[model samples]
Target: MNLIKTLIFDFGDVFINLDKEGAMANALEIFEVDTFPEELTHVNCRYEMGLITTKAFLEFYATKFPNLTQGTILHAWNCILRDFPKHRLAFLKKLQAEKKYNLILLSNTNELHIDWIKNEIPFYEEFKSCFNRFYLSHEINLRKPNSNIYEFVLTENNLTPSECLFVDDLKENTDSASKLGINTWNINPETDDVTQLFDVNKRLF
Candidate 1:
């Protein structure tokens, strides 16, 4: 394997555990709908890309579910986010201290989810500090599984794809990176831990 000079990581499921299905169920229950509205999905995409403001995103939901309060909508929307493990933080810190690879965090996250993380996770800043580059989809106006976003990172960093290793919980995101000649690890949070990165991917190291 080629020497890995850079490591790109996904936030959700890779570092922080996400209850995606639970959050979906919570939203459906709060909206009192059997299925998610197509319009809601469209608005969500725009919101994730920062094309819409948080107020506008909430207002759209408020209009759809007249009986639900904004607070309730916000709760359901943020339910996907869960705890960040201490072990992973320690591992990242170790990596940062070593100064071996350029660590980058590239997450498909939005304003609300990030807000929740800021308030809920006391060490959010410390975790972020470990990374050389932090790229949030909403803040960057780019998202995963899209070649442009990956290309932007490569171009901005002057990184060679073959020397970068991307870790993501989503297969699609990793698959996309792989197409560009980057190494990828499709992590399964159920059985995998980010703290075990070096041990798990020993071949790469």
Candidate 2:
């Protein structure tokens, strides 16, 4: 390997543990839906693609389930909020302070998730400041599992694919980046913590 000069990270399972199933169950219960509705799934896809605004998303769900209040829907949507371990943040910060490889965060997230992070995680602002660059799928209108997204980051940052390493929880996303020549680490948050990847200080110099 080229002794990676840039580190690209995924947000959801990679940084924080997301309660996807829990959130969906809550949403289903609040709406009295039998299973994950197609509309709900489609709306989420749109949300992930940044095609719809958060307010619009809430309204859409509210409209679908007229009996549900905006607050209830919001709560269900935000049920996925989980903790971002301070140790992980601390490790990344150490790399930042040491002027390590350019660090970037690329996440496929939505408005509800963003809102939850701001309100729930007290260190959200501090955590974000550690990255050299941040790219949210919803904000960028592009998402992983798509090669173009990987290309966009490479082209925009003027980074060579061979010089960067990407860490993601999803295999599909890693496949896309790999096709573009970016080295990848398919990390399982349940089993692997990112700090074990490399010596932060050593990687920098």
Candidate 3:
């Protein structure tokens, strides 16, 4: 609605396709570990919280599989990297040009995946420039769907939750924002095209 003055977008599946399956498969092979242990979720949480460096993550994996090299673990961790769709970027750029809302990117991302983006994506800077503020979870030391993160964004941006529209692929992330009065759009990137959420021309205004 017209009350929405800020558009907070999630980076991963919302704007890009992440190869989780590929990453897991690669991790299994490279780590020489039977599979990702249940503790992996906790480890990933710590990584996203910036508690552990990329090297530390690799070392942890290597410790589990003595035969695995640092390079192998790093590569396995990076297997989730993928290309950002040009059309989606063009849409975001168009939104920026419209100046209708203050655009912000809020993502729970780690250094390794971000490094891959910098190297693999030619339009990384251009994509970044579209947002008024870019908040990476690791950099901020906060990750969704943590309510503290939602509060942090609101307080830091001086944005009322009601005036913000949070778009994310994950239900839990949006749910957290929604609880704070932000409008939410759960964009299913797998089967749904994001551009159809609103007409590019209309949003440009």
Candidate 4:
């Protein structure tokens, strides 16, 4: 809360709602597996980090689950993403209008998921415009829970971690930021709304 001048946000579960558990259960049922295999997760991480192309990602899943087609795998993968609330976009635009802080979006997203979002959310560009910097993991070749990603943001923006606040739904993501002296709110998506930011973290404001 040391005079925060920047706000770094996580996209999933922060602005856009996600069905993580539901998506997992759906994939498990389809794949006939109780838990995701290590190789599957590895491929996914590579995909998210931009080490693999969209075609390669789909082919990996299709080849591994030979009984399923690429389209089926694509559907299962995208099912995790859900609604991007208009209220959240309003909140962001309001923040931008105030011009009190720099707004940044740092998300662990991939090509397919973003393509789907662009088609589904008509105001996607407007929402993105509110941010000073919009970074997708695949585009940046970096993903969170890794300290280097936070460092990259800080270095690129010439920001001091102590003067920045990172809001994320994932504790691990927030924890990583906290280590670098960044103020953080590990928001609970079920009970918390991003529109209530001022009230929830009033001390920082």
TM-score of each: 0.96, 0.90, 0.90, 0.98
Candidate 4 local accuracy as lDDT? 0.93
Give residue 86's error in model 1 in angstroms.
0.8
lDDT of each: 0.92, 0.85, 0.84, 0.93
Identify the runs in model 1 with alpha carbons over 4 angstroms from their true place. Answer: none
TM-score: which candidate is best?
A: 4
**Where does candidate 4 have its weakest 10-residue lDDT segment?**
1-10
> Residue 40: error of model 4 in Å?
0.6
The best candidate in terms of lDDT: 4
Model 3 scores worst on lDDT over the 10 consecutive residues at 196-205
Sorted by lDDT, highest first, which candidate order results?
A: 4, 1, 2, 3
* Candidate 2 C-alpha lDDT tens digits along 1-205: 3377899999888778888778877777777778987877888888998999888887887788888778887778777878888888888889899886899999999877888898888988998999989999998999888888899999999998988889998999898899989988888777888887774224522
Q: Write model 1 residue lDDT over 1-205, tens digit each, in one string.
A: 5479999999999888899999999888878789999988889988999999999998988898888888898889999999998888998999999999999999988999999999999999999999999999999999888999999999999999989999999999999999999999999989999887888888888
User: Model 4: how far is 143 from its true place, Å?
Assistant: 0.6
Better of 1 and 4 by lDDT: 4
Return the TM-score for candidate 1, rounded to 2 decimals: 0.96
